[model samples]
Target: MTFSADYLLDRIRLKRRLRIWQGIGILAICAALLALAARFDVFGHGDHIARLWVEGIIRDDVARDEMIAELKRDPKVKAVIVRINSPGGSVVGGEALYRNLRDLANEKPVVAVMGEVAASAGYMTALAADYIVAREGTITGSIGVLMQSANVKGLMEKIGVKPVIIKSAPLKAAPNPMEDLTPQSRKATEAVILDMFDMFQSMVMERRNLSKAEVSRLADGRIYTGRQAKNARLIDETGSEAAALAWLKREKKVPSTLEVIDAIYGEEDLWAGAQSAIAKSFFDKTLISKGLSLDGLISVWQPELK
Candidate 1:
């Protein structure tokens, strides 16, 4: 009886060792697969066209420039489709993205498809594309610049608080919230807005092939439906992603059989997820603070406060 018991105990120990080894082997295989996917972009692989999404507010660090850089490097990507759904944001951010997309267009065919609300700076970015497509109900075309300031003197007085600001010149901080805007300060601010507005006008006229008078008529800081914009010659066609893809194949000669890859940057694994979350949080905070203050110029459309 003792000998039989000893043999059974030894067998159980051997089985446990095999189970552990099997688990380790499985883990090793999974790690190897993930490594391979990263090296080759296997999970997000495509042969010809690269689809990039430009959603939310247009920001500097939303992986847009990085994605364009990647597309420039990859020779296999024959064309690009930029999908936009935004109300617009900072002027500089929009300008940077617009220029980058234009640079990419010089290399390969680039198409911009507007989603629900691509206005202001969002429309600016779309101008960089070789062809622009919009849905019939898509809201677009707020071709203007805006500068705003708040007078909080009453609120400060009510709260028993006084804040003082020192600047190099009266015009340096022309639109301060703590004081009433002087006529001189207001004029200075208006001049800055006019300069930016002229730039915006020029870009639209040059890109959309509209005359100065035509652009002047459209640059009233008013939003338009896609049908209205198409009639006004601001956008090329009214359609969805499928129509955009069809244009790629029919006009640009990109193969329909080629896989369409979403080439947005920072779409890796868990580490990428955490990084994107942190970056998004920072962007949100910055946008909110900027919205509350009037420190800079914006190419955004602010709807009426009800």
Candidate 2:
């Protein structure tokens, strides 16, 4: 009957689950209506601050880019706030997002509010914003780019299997995992990494207005706490979305009463609504089925197993 809070209790009473599902059904209905309203701009038509939730993995999203680009011309969108919560992803993904945000910033005020962890590419996205805020415990920075490859040459050799690679040039398939990494191939791969790192380094230097030496000192692929980041001049201050709004009101003169709308939640927000419903269903099936016995009554204290 007792278990961790973040995770569901190891054993759930069937009686409680019935009520939970009933409530989930109501939420599902409300979410649907909300999506329809958002799609049609039912509750949002006047001047407002657009909120872009940058969650999960960062990647090149053409549809999202197009939506953001449209904001550049949106007169009603008085300002934009980017809420970031990610551990970073591809270099090009971060670069494209940065450019798009910078373009938007040219026309309207843009602020970034970091969540739990916004490092690497996530940090790059924030750099494009006019101002940045984060929780005191948030993890920011980790300003670097990297490429990784795994080698199975030893495994292949042990299995008596050889790889036949045909390429136009030596550097074409430089880091093939099935083959030995020659000095030439290693040097070529390192060159690519260094070149990409230079791009990341330049972005930090130019966006933050820091000297090359200052950027080099901080961009050693290290993460800094929100407080440390402020002291290091990596971010403006440490706070939350409320702080971001206050800055906009003071500096950009954006009205605090303006309704905040989601920048990316348009016709496709139905999917987001459905995802919430589906997640609850998935959780019920996974937890209940695994924890139950043939008699539909099973209780064995196994916190580690759960």
Candidate 3:
């Protein structure tokens, strides 16, 4: 009986030791998993500032809008910094980005940091920010709308080709390259440009709190340096991204120590992007082959330096 009792006590001790080791292993695994989660922001568990880089030609993208929506929904994102570096692109692209950024601004503080060139639609995007910051030499402020068309009537005549069109109205196929543009069509095109320009001008006036005369002076399709823009009240300040962040900390009450992480949602499908590029190239080539240029509504600063 004494031997059996001693054996039972030994068995109890071993079982307790085994349970302790198992608990330690479980805790170690939990700690590792937690570290991984923090690193990847899986649960959005910590405070951070999101940096959104908008470089190259801007295009209207549904995926981009979705990503911005995600940024709005993220609780860990205390503020947003939009870094723009482009000569601008389609007016619709810039307008869409501006709208999304404004929506994001409603949820969190947002600032824009201009890079080398932020003109036309780029400037429009900057206007969406709650605060604007640009480098001293940054080229900006080509505020206007544009449309271009070409007349290939001479080339068509030389090639012995005849153009045919059947339309319900005189202006239905008004600006085709194979034909001449009527006076009525020219006036119609100008009207469209003017209407868009009005929208852009109004956006600037309201965003910058400038009077009509002030906006009129700045919105004449001229580029302005960052310093000039600041003087003209086109931008709020002349500074870099660091200065922009400092402003957020000092004025907006965001913590200065929060980590800044890039807000790249994910890489767009490679084939989709490639296919779009190919399609654009094909379209441009086809137009040129027919003695014409790409004609569309755009707000871009395409400078030809010689």
Best by lDDT: 3
Query: lDDT per model, in order?
Result: 0.82, 0.79, 0.83
Q: Which tens-of-lDDT digit does each residue in 1-306 have in candidate 1?
A: 356878999999999999999997776566556554643587666477887878776767655687797898898899999988888877877888898998999999999999988999899999999889999999999988888778999999899998888889888767888988999999888998899889888889889999999999999989999999999999999999888889999998988887776563655664443334334335333534244222367777657779
Q: Estimate, for each residue in 134-253, the C-alpha lDDT of model 2 and write its tens digit.
A: 888988888877665679989988899987888898777667787778899989777877887888888888878899999999988888999999999999989989999999999999
lDDT of 2: 0.79
- Clashing residue pairs in candidate 2 are none
Candidate 3 regions with alpha-carbon error over 4 angstroms: 1-40, 43-45, 269-295
Q: Poorest 10 consecutive residues of model 2 by lDDT?
A: 294-303
lDDT of 1: 0.82
Q: Is candidate 1 or candidate 2 better by lDDT?
A: 1
TM-score of 3: 0.77
Better of 1 and 2 by TM-score: 2
Give the Å shift of residue 216 in candidate 1.
Answer: 0.5
Candidate 3: Cα lDDT at 125 = 94
Cα error, candidate 2, residue 229 (Å): 0.7
Model 3 clashes, total count: 0
Ordered from best to worst lDDT, the candidate numbers read: 3, 1, 2
lDDT of 1 at 56: 73
lDDT of 3 by residue, 1-306 (tens): 356878999999999999999997776566555444433578755888988877667778787788788889989899999989877778789899999999999999999999999998899999999999999899999999998778988998889988787789988866778778999999998998999899999999899999999999889899999999999999989988889889999999999999887665434443333323233234233533222232367888877659
